[model samples]
Target: MALLGYARVSTSHQKLTAQISELKSSGVREDRIFTDMMSGATDEREGLQRLLARAEQEDIILCTKMDRLGRNTSDMIKIVDTCYKKGIAIRFLENGLSTEGTMGKMVIQILAAVAEAERERILERTNEGRVVAMAAGVKFGRKPHQGSGMALELIHLDTPIKLVMEKTGISRATYFRLKNHQRRS
Candidate 1:
């Protein structure tokens, strides 16, 4: 079995320099490293699936931290348990723990608990924010009639929807919906 490394960042804008360096320093080869440049909440990551598929018994899975692997405790535990049952082990660099020992198991459990609580708190705050926004007539995310300046000018000039889409990069759905919305108002 090979020593596999996994790194993850929440957004595409972030770089994997630190994670890559740390994993390499820990004796994981560059070719054996797997990385996911998406949120920990998403399980459909490319490098993550590759690690899960390629890793085998006695193989080591190195990560920066527990949260980098996953946010929800249940999900994290489930993933870890899968690795454990498969004879795969995990090494958390920051925590300096390995799933090969009892203390590491305890630490992993505790970290997972804390991460789960953090996820719950985040969800609660998000729900409260949504409620406040709704009461104040504030819409979250993309809103209709929020076209670009150029698109607005073109719409006012009675330009074709296709032309507006080309100029503003707005999708066809957003274009027609915004056009009809402006006409109605």
Candidate 2:
């Protein structure tokens, strides 16, 4: 039975060095390590998809943390259930836990719930900060282009759309959107 390792980071800016090192220390080969630089909330990760497809009976899937498997409690439970059914075991290094027996399963369930609660709390805090910023008159989206008015003026003067875009550094989509807005006005 092969020991497989999976590492995940929320974005491209984050590194998987620590997790990879831990997995390597645990005797998982570099080639057997799968990684996803995407949100744990989504299961559509390419690396995860490949790992799940390649896993077989008696194969052990190792992760640095339980959250690396998934953040959603229901999804985590489903994954654990599927692994149990397939005779594949999951091991979380941080918690020193494995899906091996009744007690392990119980601990996994509790951890999954805690992980999900933590995720929700994080979301709530982020939303609260955004609301506070908005109340303080802070705009959250992209600032209007400094040359937007110039682009509109050029359009009104019958200048070519491509030239207007080049002069204003505006994309074709944005130019068209402005044109449509003008027409509506």
Candidate 3:
């Protein structure tokens, strides 16, 4: 009969502070909380695994939102199902939903499906926009290293690679990446 809190963020750049604050304010002890920084697309969550293993029958699993568990319907359903079979209940604080009864059960299925569909729509639109941008000669991702050209040019001039890197402020990793790209081309 414990309340275990779970918090997640899609990227390392995102913070867990907000979700952790919410969980703590909800009376979930700090020691009973688990947090992970990873995308929903990733399946390996060390924090979640430990939380699930520690949860016992009649224990409650608390989270900020349904999507934090996972993005897709099947994945969410699978997680809920696992909890249910173990006699554990899941509560989403933001939605005020609990999987301790019949009605809550139905709502979870609907929410999971809706979340999955929304994720799909977002990905589709992003791909479409990328295609349109590419057609317009737009570049995506990090701009090429400013010194890449200089490094390459210096390499061609028979300068030592280290000297070229120091002069152009190019990192060894970036220099190797550019050299690999050149080889591939």
On lDDT, the candidate that comes out on top is 2
Model 2, 1-185: lDDT tens per residue?
99999999999999999999999999999999999999888677899889988899999999999889897888788888888889889999997999988789779989899878887899999999999999999998898788889988888888899899999999998898888878898
> For residues 14-125, what per-residue lDDT tens digits would candidate 3 score against the true structure?
9999999999999899999998898765446898889889999999999999888887787788788889889999999997999888778778989889888888899999
The per-candidate count of clashes, in order, stands at 0, 0, 0
Q: Ten residues in a row with the worst lDDT in model 2? A: 71-80
Better of 1 and 3 by lDDT: 3
Worst 10 residues of 3 by lDDT: 39-48
Q: Which sections of candidate 2 miss by over 4 Å?
A: 10-17, 42-59, 152-172
Model 3 residue pairs with clashes = none
Please list the residue runs of candidate 1 whose C-alpha ends up more than 4 Å from where it truly belongs after superposition.
129-179, 182-185
Cand. 1 Cα-lDDT? 0.84
For model 3, the local distance difference test gives 0.88
Ordering by TM-score = 3, 2, 1
Count: clashes, candidate 2: 0
- Model 1, position 70, has a per-residue lDDT of 83
Q: Which residue pairs overlap in candidate 2's backbone?
A: none
TM-score of 1: 0.68
